[model samples]
Target: MKEDINNDRILLERLKNGDISCFEILYSKYSGKLYNYVLNISKGDFYLAEEIVQNVFVRIWEIHRHIETEGSFGSFVYTVGKNMFLNVIKNRMQEYLYHDYIIEHASELDNTVEKEVEYKMLEEQINKLIEQLPPARRKVYILSRVKHLPNKEIAALLDISENTVESQLTKATRFMRENLSPYCEIIALGLFQFYVS
Candidate 1:
């Protein structure tokens, strides 16, 4: 294990020097373990956890050229991964609290029956917007986002490539933006606040 760690450090140096093969080697070595770690902590919210993992890798790759050795590369990567996971959890919790606030205050309206009816109507509209997506894209979105499957698992379940699953999600998001413009705008604003602050 000590020798392996030394080799990994060398590979990380090569990766920092823009060696694609070294980067691939590091990815192949660690992706599964890191995915499982994130998945475990996320408690089945695999889609979000997967996004966190991707962000961690992207950040590492972007800053690799500047990351002078102050510690083990593995430890640095794991620290990045942990921080990303914490951010995701914090953002999700805030979103949950906001949704709860909306629901609670909505229930306190004087015209409770009317408010309920309006809420149901809005929910129906959102469902309609989702339905407007292409069949495959809709399925992928539902399974990955709603069902909370990781991309690899989603690919296996849908008999498609992980890249295809990602592509479908991108299309699904575009469709949602076009069809549910108002809701998309609101969500985008909320997400900006969630991440930027």
Candidate 2:
């Protein structure tokens, strides 16, 4: 907790100075948590939660120059999300209309989970394919992809040269592409899109 606070302070200081990377890193760290927090409070109104999260970030960007670098950026964003949600609710007519619209479109909303399920199924399929890889290639590929290790780290761990690690990764990726893409078009559009495309 202390480390995260200190890190947020550093990121906030950089963001106030107009550093886009700092803003991006902060977004990556907080966006999912913020979205989930808002989504729960908004009673599973996906669109409303999404809007509040977007507004929170936009407000942060707008006020970057006035940001207090010593404070908790996480708390600041959540407070903003909460306040924005409250303001939306205070406009009772809008909330009523939004809920009415949601009730009418509940069936379509139900399909959203199916897409997520499909993505997970695709992930499982990919993992099975990975298991079929040659041993050395499999280790290098897992270290690179699943563990997200750099080529140098992978090489050091495997007691091989960086060039060898790179070669193994290349071959492993080609194998997945050739085997999976032929049967799974899901790869062409999902997170694994780069592999198939």
Number of the top TM-score candidate? 1
Q: What TM-score fits each model?
A: 0.49, 0.45
Per-residue lDDT tens digits for candidate 2, residues 54-162, read 8888867876766776667788788778877876775565457557855886775577677678778877878898889998898888877774445654654566899
Candidate 2, residue 57: Cα displacement in angstroms equals 0.4
Candidate 1 ranges with C-alpha deviation above 4 Å = 1-6, 107-197
**Could you give candidate 1's per-residue lDDT for residues 1-197 as a string of tens digits?**
34644487677777769987777777777777778888887787778778877876776676566554546667666766776687567657988987876677664556857755765655576678677877888888887655444565466556688999998888776666565555443344243233112
- The ten-residue window of minimal lDDT in model 1 covers 188-197
Q: Which stretches of candidate 2 lie over 4 Å from their true place?
A: 1-6, 93-197
Question: What 10-residue stretch in candidate 2 is worst by lDDT?
Answer: 188-197
Best candidate according to lDDT: 2
Global lDDT scores for all candidate models? 0.67, 0.75
How far off is residue 32 in model 2, in Å?
0.5
RMSD of each: 11.8, 14.8
